[model samples]
Target: MPVSPTDPVSPIDPDSTTGPDSTIGTAAAIAAATIAAAAAADDSTGTDALPYAGGNPYADYRHGEFAFTALTDLADRRLGGAVLAANDELFAERENLLLPEPAEFRPHTFGNKGQIMDGWETRRRRGAGTARPHPTAEDHDWALIRLGVPGIVHGVVVDTAHFRGNYPRQIAVEATELPGTPGPEELLAADWEPLVPRSPVRGHAANGFAVASRRRVTHLRLSQYPDGGIARLRVHGEARPDPAWLAALGTFDLAALEYGGAVEDASDRFFSPPANMIMPGRSRSMGDGWENRRRRDEGHDWVRLRLAGRGVVRAVEIDTGYYVGNAAGWAALYGRDEHGAPDDWFELVPRTRLQPDAVHRLLLPGARPVTHVRLDVFPDGGIARLRLHGSLLDD
Candidate 1:
């Protein structure tokens, strides 16, 4: 799904903790377990294969394991993903699942429950028994997660980081579409379809799973077979939003993920994901933006995106809000009707000097229908938001 065939994998960005608000600062998580479940991972899927012998298995999933994992994280809290409810989080709070950073392990960090962990953890379960009855195979601990941008999950990463000994032996993932706001009770009862069937997991490893379901998912039910810890859960997919809702707003950010726009490919994703550039609402802080490492050599860094649909462009907003010292030096936007030769793209906004931590609204040269766009940032820096303001074209 490259806008350009030259879309080689860029350097993996250093681990970053970039969720920007209480609503998202620390939300949902995706996890993978030990090598024991390595067989379960579909090696046929590029996103499930690790290109390098890793230092951190969890790190592989983002750039190495599954290429699709690099797509927009549908359950990212920054995009409004939430860990709505968990049958149990008695050990580690469920919110830690989506911290937007690596799960750190601290020695002897004790809470009232015992040792504190950075990912979701649940207490051991005991079935109804006269003695110390073991938890039946049917017993499982579960958590409900609301997708930030509803879409079809292409792949999932289950990281059991720091959950070595206490990680669940098996896990399963199920999803369903609930367009409107749903309460915990209602969501729990909603019809659900399996995304990943019950599978073994190894502790302290990033376990990757390939999902084949084509249904648009709004929420996920993650189950830990018979109760155990799970560090994080990531659902990577393309956003599939309702066009009718977008039409109701009339003029809107045609590039908004909730409206179906997507980060097609990027040169980098560091400090934060490039996908954040089109997320809804104003960026709350520097961490709410997309950033890349400083370029030591030549050409500028760029991020290409798929527009919600064919739309006429009028103006654009490049926000560097809160990126005082690290804002891009200059930026530009280009448009394309479909993926083709490099020259198929035309300029939307010429390269213009950017003010640090400021919002710049620049009008396009003229109106034209564009189905894709590419944003180029001079040298290397972070951008809080990239708003493509325009109206959609009729089918």
Candidate 2:
């Protein structure tokens, strides 16, 4: 994984579940200095402010978090035996199980062999095509990593550039929260191969070939198999340390009707809210303004949610009441910044107007670094649950 700028240090172990909040201790001072430097090094693009009417301006303030804290916690857990690392370099035994005594997070099902075991040995179930699992392979016969550090992970990095094979089986880096039963478990932001070209390894690869970076991760899962050659994997990220600081990884309580409330299945792009979209009774005509398109139709109404972050936002997701067909076209996305600064207004959906009973995704521009988010629909627009994700670097 892509390593953060922070240098490695001995991690602390705590039997309790709480985390530190940056005290006046030596460790805290070092952490503060490190964070300041890292933040200064970041170079982000696309920032805009919006104007709003009335409401608490800092509803999302509580969501703000730091990355250094996460790193400390990860190190402590790993060294203190609360986590796992390169425990077994040699895969001489069967089923290289490396589970954290107290699992940071559980898996969707035990079927995913890599759910608990960090590494495993297996040959192709089918033909001898390098002995790697098929691209369409159902069972996961590799290793797994769990972030379960309970912090806003700004990024995650995975290293797999050095291995032995030609057409190596595609490996996936998945994330989720524990107790994933009853759905809404695996909050998937991205789940695709890190590399573009298909290049396998025959032995040790480069120093930083296989590395990845992600944002807001509590549980990280790596699924890969051998393709006639074994590969090594490492995970890195912007995280909060344990025992003193914890940032809930996955979304708080979000339910997307489009994907049956299954965060994992929820596509990165938002087409609309869950099926049960409706506005409150007080709001007449419009039901829950949040609704996803059942099919890709002309002017289909949809909602787009950025990843979870910590910052100020100018706009809010309003519960319009009902899925007002074709009325959103004339509507506009509004917002305000600090000191109630009114900013420029932008069209909710630049393309065609909203189509009634249609699913579409809309973007609200000029969103400042704010926590909470809401979609304010006109009297005609409705909403069910205006769920949002993504994280802000500013702690």
lDDT at position 239, candidate 1? 83
Give the local distance difference test score of model 1: 0.74
Regions of candidate 1 where Cα sits further than 4 Å from its true position? 1-9, 12-64, 268-272, 284-287, 339-343
lDDT of 2 by residue, 1-395 (tens): 11222221222222223222212222234344544543453223211112222353222111112233222223122322122222223322222222211111122324433323222334443533667434444443333344423433333222222122221354454554343221222323325333212232212121122223333444544444333223233332333333211144332212221111111111111333222231112223332233332333232222222223344332223333345553444333322222233233223323334455444444346545432222323322334334333223346
Worst 10 residues of 1 by lDDT: 19-28
What would the per-residue lDDT of candidate 1 be over residues 254-279, giving only the tens digit for each residue?
Answer: 89887888776666764567877887
Candidate 2, run of 10 with poorest lDDT: 259-268
Query: What lDDT would each prediction earn against the true structure?
Result: 0.74, 0.30
lDDT measured at residue 158 in model 2 versus the true structure, 0 to 100: 27
Whole-model lDDT, candidate 2?
0.30
> Residue 358, candidate 2: how far off, in angstroms?
69
